[model samples]
Target chain A: MNFNTDFTPLTVDPDKIYDYSFSIIEEEMGEHSFTDDQWKVVRRVIHASADFELGRSVMFTPDAIEAGIQSILAGRHVIADVQMIESGSGRKRFQKHGGDLHCYIADPDVAKEAKEQNTTRAIISMQKAVRENEGGIYAIGNAPTALLELIRLIKEGVAKPDLIIGMPVGFVSAAESKAELAKLEGIPFITNVGRKGGSTVTVAALNAISILADERAKK
Target chain B: MNFNTDFTPLTVDPDKIYDYSFSIIEEEMGEHSFTDDQWKVVRRVIHASADFELGRSVMFTPDAIEAGIQSILAGRHVIADVQMIESGSGRKRFQKHGGDLHCYIADPDVAKEAKEQNTTRAIISMQKAVRENEGGIYAIGNAPTALLELIRLIKEGVAKPDLIIGMPVGFVSAAESKAELAKLEGIPFITNVGRKGGSTVTVAALNAISILADERAKK
Candidate 1:
């Protein structure tokens, strides 16, 4: 451990680093089918993970970008599967449109319901969203159960989200859940094919949508 | 969109999923050199990211785990680089030990300081941490500038933290900062090589240390 200390970093400006990162992503990620709007979200995901494969794996429904942009512009709230997504999301962007991000996984009532029903808090959270939130964006990042439950609710005609960003990462049905999400029609969705998505990448996807909405609003 | 609706998930039980995920990780992540305590931390990282390559790249100083446990047991607060790490951390565990997790990146004062100095809020946040948070665990996961600044403060003898968990993610300066942290002597640090870490993985690492500390306290 030599404390010689003569290591200067590139640039300390946050914005510069962000711009430089996007430049690198554009240069490295060649030839994609995503439209400019969809690419915004994919670029941010790649920027967040530095994984071009995961970024390229991202799939957006025909109306995903449009649905997300309209919902965000309309001030529709966001339902995150975990606290990490709620915390990491660009809340100010949501708030600027009169919306907020909510996560009920740690709520006492959700916990009590999960314990009583022998279900995950994520499942209970989606159920709670059905009653408390409508026409909001559903962001499922950490729990396959939550994504599956939301899909069930959508099938049952009880949950009608403006958009679903389902990107749960893990074994034990993570890939299956995303596959289910991708197969669903009518409701717009943004998901990936593999078990590579998590709260961080999900947050990036949401932030990208928000940025696009913000840009559109500026026009 | 097939409204067929008959897709039940593998299990709705959260604990079962957690257990099953760990079993898979244990079986798959065979032949590691980490001690039991270190494996506890690394396992959680693998669980969070589901990336075996990233998890295997974790490096810990000789005294890293012990320093973390002692700091946590002594109820030393944690200073996170971003809100995601602070929000995602197991606050109850820290509170049980009489400590808290804090992130000053969003503070107005820190923003002002960054603007005045033409530096990132991450750098200013570290400067603030030096003044307001001594002997606390410094968990940096999003900004290489913050990690580099902390390393500078450590070398200058102005910052004395119990542990430094530096794992910022990105293409620019992320790997270089961790490399510099690895070279620092007499500091208990946990980091990884390459550009594959972020707030989620850093939170996982901190939570693992807190779990270890809690387990030891029960003994």
Candidate 2:
């Protein structure tokens, strides 16, 4: 059976694929205000989504990249709002640096607490996360409720994290949760404006930070 | 510390949030040619990505939705290309119907085999999956290589899946693999054009099919 090959893929090698992807992204994403370090994180987000619109919408605090890198180098853990982020992340990179990734959404205790409180597992997970992963990097990818809860925790002085990656996707409260995150002070965060974010894109952003951290360590 | 709440989220209730999201998607998606069943899947894809352009690009074989629903009802398992799809899926819905989710990308044997073959774990995983899960649903979300391998297996008459959800996102072979899937005949499949798909969106599509299956079973 002969197959009609309309578009031939450039290459199948993983490393070369990444290099080619970055080059295309760089060419398409003409001029940007992000620093060299910040562009790496944004480029990966664009690569993951293939949506330059969302990539350009990404916002980062001045110290967010350096804060995330330092958190990784210091062996701090990551508190993921959902298991998808944990599953999609480069865990070995974190593990090699004596850091780990944690997601409390599936924990029985969190489930029970959420049920008892008449709230979401996302909120309960963040509460449990603060007590466990001090100085951790909080990554909220899918749930807007989780990002809102984290913002509340930061405001209440109940949680202190080195960095917060708040890019939750949905129609109900996603954009609002991110807007709240932008209003937060004293906590470095990487987020975007609008309702276009997900576990895959959040994983891409976190992986970018981890890659930068790893590169820094090697140097 | 007082927080500036400019935009308040509609609701924190999970069920209400889904209802709200679907309403927004229905209102924003405008006119579409998809049937009711197909629209359900496509609507969920739009909800997951928040990108109408990508959602509009989704294509389905005439029998794709019915095939996916029948497969779920028949207790056929799912072979995921990445762990994120498995993690993000509503596994409870599938499990309640006696179906299960499987991802072989992390298996030691697949990794070792990929090293020996000088290929990706995705390719090796598909090779192993075709042997194990006959009449299963093949869900490829992250790896273009896995989708291409599955297409090869199908062309060779080695793999016979009930439904194929081939939407791998990347700059390398993503668009090409999907283009290849579109060219296949006599196979029920759900896929989108271009490099705009991911584990979250794939999970959304699968969950929509499973929901329809469950609804049918209830009736």
Candidate 3:
């Protein structure tokens, strides 16, 4: 059963992994109230993270999931705030239709300008991302400051995001930033309301949304 | 401030980032006792994560940091249990010689085999990693089962790693696995003592060690 990925031996099947993950999530979340689409997002997040608590924390604008699906189907870009978010996103499959997964935090120029501006590289990275790709998915999984900056950019009419996935984990500003993101209008968003989110969960959301898009297209 | 990377613009200088990181760490850790080298790994983890609590949680064997530095200098391979660790590792600099970073969790074969075995891809990935590299750095950041499997392989005489960097996050087995890793005689390691480790911190430690090796070579 060794699956091969780029010539390496894999011990898990992608579909089977997700299938079993949903099983676990369902078993653990007995007697809970969640819509089918909400389960689609939360179950995958649990699969990626094994953090069941996340199921309770996840929030989405009424149209956020559908917005993400539409954007993905349209081949809009997906810009992650950090490399892990981009890398774990099942990036190749999601972007198989010409969409791109981009992260500028590791870019040398971002680090340099961040220092000069005395601001977080994440803030600068968001600006670069907005400039490069408008009306794209903004996946912020590692930096609350990046999410804040994205919101700020939008407020300034400098950035347009079709859907925002904000789940940066930590203590300071992690929860606060998500709260701010949750309140943003005119921009659809999925957020975990507290400090319990991370890159893995963010990527899970991306993967689930991509899968949803594929499923919807087949129908 | 021109940090060179692919495509995305970066702004923070590497040196300045680390300097500011150390200052934040110092301010957060008002009265702690750590040697200079331990601070190197801890401060960088905090920099990468913005989690000051990590500075207190990071643990290192007396020689683990040095062991990792020497392994890189000698051009040994780095095998991360997860993609995030591999991606965050500043892998190119450490492998400026002929060393490489290997991760098989995303391997299709591993995924398939893991489903068949009712085990994690991480476990199978560890076995494959051991077969491919000896006396390399074993970097396990996202899965305790992988670290446990590595130890089992070592006990079974299947492999020998120069150093172990285990920082798997979660509630179950995260701290327990690190405790076991610390007990392995003659196998140097860097680990957090509790459930406070993650991929970012693990990679931060890896990057810090690489920087130390580069600094040492400069002299």
**lDDT winner:** 2
Model 1 score (lDDT)? 0.88
Off by over 4 Å in 2: A1-10, B1-10
lDDT of 1 by residue, B1-219 (tens): 321253343367666677777888898888989998899899989888888999999999989999999998998899999989988895677888988888999999999988998889999999898899769899999999999999999999999999999999888788889999999998899999998899889998999999889889999
Local accuracy by lDDT, each model: 0.88, 0.89, 0.78
| Candidate 1 deviant stretches above 4 angstroms | A1-10, B1-10
lDDT of 1 by residue, A1-219 (tens): 221243243367677778777887888888989998888899999888877888999999889988999999999999999988998995677999889888989999999999998788899989998889868899999999999999999999998999999999986788889999989989999999887889999999999888888888999
* Tens digits of per-residue lDDT for model 2, B119-153: 78899999999999878899899999899999999
The candidate with the higher DockQ, 2 or 3, is: 2
User: Per-residue lDDT for A1-219 in model 2, tens only?
Assistant: 112242234354667678878888888799999999999999999999998999999999999999999999999999899999999995787889999999999999998998897788998999899988878899999999899888888888899899999999978789988999998889999999998999999999999999999899989
Regions more than 4 Å wrong, model 3: A1-59, A96-98, A104-128, A131-134, A143-145, A169-183, A192-198, A211-219, B1-25, B29-34, B46-58, B106-121, B170-179, B193-196
lDDT of 3 at B209: 86
lDDT of 2 at B161: 90
Error of 1 at A181 (Å): 0.5
Q: Classify candidate 2 by CAPRI docking class.
A: medium
DockQ of 1: 0.70
Model 3: how far residue A3 lies from native, Å: 27
Ranking by lDDT: 2, 1, 3
Which 10-residue window in model 3 chain B sums to the lowest lDDT? B2-11
In the range B144-174, model 3's lDDT, one tens digit per residue, is 7898889888888887899999988654456
How do the residues A53-121 of candidate 3 rate in per-residue lDDT, one tens digit apiece?
666789988899999999988889999988887766757866676788899998999989888887788
